[model samples]
Target: MSRKTGTLLCLIAGSMMLIIGCSKSSEDRLTTPIPPSDCDTVNMTYSSDVQPILEANCYSCHGNGNVNGGVTLDSYTGVKLVADNGLLIGVITHAPGYPPMPDGGGKLSDCDINKIKDWINRGASNN
Candidate 1:
């Protein structure tokens, strides 16, 4: 092809590619990105945050009137006992000489642990 025609074709091809790259389809734009974690540990409350974690992980053995190891967590009073003694944090954090909690299960999630710590640092109230 003539030099001018060849140059025109190259420009057209580049322009088409630019348009295609810029004008992505709705489906392409609608990418299902893995959203960041919604692990909100702000304003952690015993009733809302701490109690739920205990009920799910500790209640089976330490709650509902079971009181295994004399460690009760089903009620605010029982929980306060451990919280005051630092046993709560020690066991949950798997500290040396302190048994890991949830019996043989893995450690609690970072978010759950953070929520508990926040509540305790806020005085571990009945709220």
Candidate 2:
């Protein structure tokens, strides 16, 4: 092979490998379940803990005025519907087969997510 042709082939191969390496891994794509160090997960409540996180992160698209994707999270009942059906947890956790919540927004902090998980584990109470 000509020197120039060999150089071109090497460049192409290197570019492909770089692209492949830059791709997100399965674990990186999923919201990693992280335990909160300072968050008090003992008594998580919908009103106190979960609502603020949702209001800040999710209400833009999923609130009463919007209801995008047929999901409204403005009220406790609305939140409860998805919570009961597992969509809330699934999306928030970025679990496979479920669309991530807050869409293009960053994933919820470990403290917030852990609080939500704790609340859900405790029956997703209205309180």
Candidate 3:
């Protein structure tokens, strides 16, 4: 074959190989069912169970009086206020009219969300 024809054939073969290699990988996709929340055993008033979850997930904006949606989850009373008003449960559960918590992205795990729900169901006490 002439030099120009040989180079053209090689370019076509390289482009085909590139296309096949770029196809999506089956293993990278998610295909499992997510479990529902388990809130029956969570205690809202206990600092051990509740504080860390709040500090890590909520404090960034809820702290220092920078409450985002007219609600605060900083102290016991603040958390209780939202809980008593049913806003906490509504947002965490992503009910139709309310947006999910942490507004930026990923939601709290089902377990954590359930714990908050359980706390609210139990009257959202400060104790």
What RMSD, rounded to one decimal, does every model reach?
A: 4.3, 11.5, 8.7
Q: Candidate 3's error at 40, in angstroms? A: 8.0
Model 1: per-residue lDDT, tens digit, 30-125?
Answer: 786754488888889998889999999999999887988889999999999999899999999998988899789999987888889889998988
TM-score of model number 2: 0.69
Give the better candidate number (1 or 3) by TM-score.
Answer: 1
- Of candidate 2, the 10-residue stretch with the lowest lDDT total is 22-31
Per-candidate Cα lDDT values, in order, are 0.90, 0.89, 0.72
Q: Write the per-residue lDDT of candidate 2 for residues 1-127, one digit (tens) a residue.
A: 9999999999999999887876756547666766556788788999989999999999999885998999999899999999899999999989999998779888888778888999989999999
Residue runs of model 3 more than 4 Å from their true location after superposition:
1-44
Clashes of each: 0, 0, 0
Q: What residue pairs clash in candidate 3, if any at all?
A: none
Model 1: CA > 4 A from native: 1-36
Predict model 3's lDDT versus the native: 0.72
Model 1 steric clash pairs: none
Show where candidate 2 strays beyond 4 Å: 1-37
Clashing pairs in 2: none
lDDT of 1 at 18: 83
